[model samples]
Target chain A: MDVNEKYFKNISNRERAIFEGAITMGALFHQFIGTPINIKSAESLEKSIKTAMELQPCINKVEIEINRDILKKIENEYEYISLTGEMLDVKVESNFSDKSAVIRLKYISELKYPLMYVEDVD
Target chain B: MDVNEKYFKNISNRERAIFEGAITMGALFHQFIGTPINIKSAESLEKSIKTAMELQPCINKVEIEINRDILKKIENEYEYISLTGEMLDVKVESNFSDKSAVIRLKYISELKYPLMYVEDVD
Candidate 1:
């Protein structure tokens, strides 16, 4: 089916279940493989999702938000991709009062394991 | 005071105040400067305290925990000292089930700033 046609086709309950299953599997793969995996430069989220799907046949889509400060730090310090799926949300706040930086992660869903330490790419 | 003499000097209430002041100042300096500042390999904790004291009149001593797995990753990836005073505690757990790594940090005592993203020196 064409992309639009497939998307417009009213998703059945069974199809939805299957899709949820895939996401669950993706979450599982992500749990096993590790989070914040490098999907930044993989053309598009669709492509990245595709890559993830190829690995586990379950992930249908993906979302990402790049922290420029983190990206800059990573670029300045290291040469590896920084990725993590276990990260539900991230907030970077620069403290002018104290002249410091704070990175906070709130409520990472499906974090079956403890937080994994990923090196900044800079 | 000689080493033993100073050691035996019963810590008075006033002296305790002074010491607490120093720790509070160290905590402030740690806030202004950033956390996890490199204190390792400065000879000893006393030396580390000395170094911090030199930088700021308020600081007295410092504490640190080195995560070896993180150390290895840092060593393998880049070259910089990994330090964070804001880091109150650290727990590193190897995930045999998922074949991954997990690093957890408990509450940091006097974190005046947001979390400083420090590069790990491997």
Candidate 2:
């Protein structure tokens, strides 16, 4: 059975693009948020997250940038901090048919919330 | 700034409920997927995931069950295995005003995908 035909026939291509990207963006945030990390481990962690999330359906790319500034200031006894939404800047690109979208997760200081939104669509 | 007024006014209450629950469900899956786990740490990991996800906007509660059968059989060199979506069964409950939704993530063997869907709404 065709997975998309069975599970995703209701939504339009644009909506599917958004849906897939949203799921991935949400997945990226929650999946990596509590991993132990310092400046030294940041790059490897970022790479791992990118590779992992990209495996999801319709996901073409996952770009992650963990805040190095936050990692640099770590003074805890453990010498590393659990990752948080505030430290993540992410863009997940997904496509369904001719439509595609980029979903972004970024910490917005004004609201003090990590905001996820549709950054681009086509 | 009024976050709901500014960022969430476009979606209906039911949509917002589904959206929030979906996001939380995705976050829950990704955030803890790679954590080192064995039967001994499964309960603690489940508790931690539930507590952390319950803090998200509109999310009322989170329920997590990590597969202990898989953990019990672990024979890896490290004595533990990284958490994977196949090992998780989760529900995220979210409400926006009178609208509420429960999003679920469970692995389906036929699809070979950990599916996320709106399990319930009211």
Candidate 3:
């Protein structure tokens, strides 16, 4: 059974690229939002997330940046905090057939929301 | 700043519902796939996940079911295993104005992929 032919025939290649990228971006935000982390663990967590998310369909690359400045300012009793959208800046590149898209997830200060959008597509 | 007007106006209400639900489903899968868990921790994890995902835009509710049979069979050295997609059954319900959608994520035995799709929409 061809997964693409069965599951994605209705959408255009461009929409499929956008769809895959958007799904990945959403997955990245939700999956790790509550993980306990400190400055020492941030690098490893970022690497793990990058490696895992790249395994998704059509995803060619995943880049993650966790804000260390926030890690350095931890004042809680645990000396760490659960990861949140504000700490993440992510880019996921996906391709379906000849079409490709770059999806971005960034925390917008004014909206106080993590925005996911198609950054570039062709 | 009108978020719906600025970022999501291009997509129809139905597409927006599908998009939000898909994002949440992806987020749910990636975020929790690596957590250490045993039978005792599964319920708490499900509750936490449901609570957190409901906070996302357009998401009305999240339902998570973690397979406890697998949890009971754990034979690892640590008495727990990192959660995987095979052990999860999830549904994310999202709404965009009058349109609503239910997004589902479940592991497919034949494809060996955790599939996310629009299960229902209006």
Q: What TM-score, over all chains together, does every model reach?
A: 0.23, 0.71, 0.74
Candidate rank order under DockQ: 3, 2, 1
* Candidate 3 per-residue C-alpha lDDT over A1-122 given as tens digits, one digit per residue, 9 for 90 to 100: 88777766656687667667878888778778889999999999999999999988899999999999989999988899999999999999999899897888888999887788656777
Evaluation by lDDT, superior candidate among 1 and 3? 3
Ten contiguous residues minimizing lDDT sum, candidate 1 chain A? A113-122
lDDT of 3 at B47: 97
Model 3 chain A weakest lDDT span, ten residues long:
A7-16
- Model 3, B9-76: lDDT tens per residue? 55667766766777778877876788999999999999999999898888999989999988999987
> Residue A77: error of model 2 in Å?
16
Question: Across residues A1-122, which tens digit of lDDT does each residue of candidate 2 receive?
Answer: 77677655555677667667877888777666779999999999999999999998889999999999988999988899899999999999999899997877889999788998767777
* The 10-residue segment with the lowest total lDDT in model 2 chain B: B7-16
lDDT by residue (tens digit), candidate 1, A16-120: 434434444335333322122233542353345435533532233333343334434433222333233333332222222212222333323343322322111
Candidate 2 CAPRI assessment class = acceptable
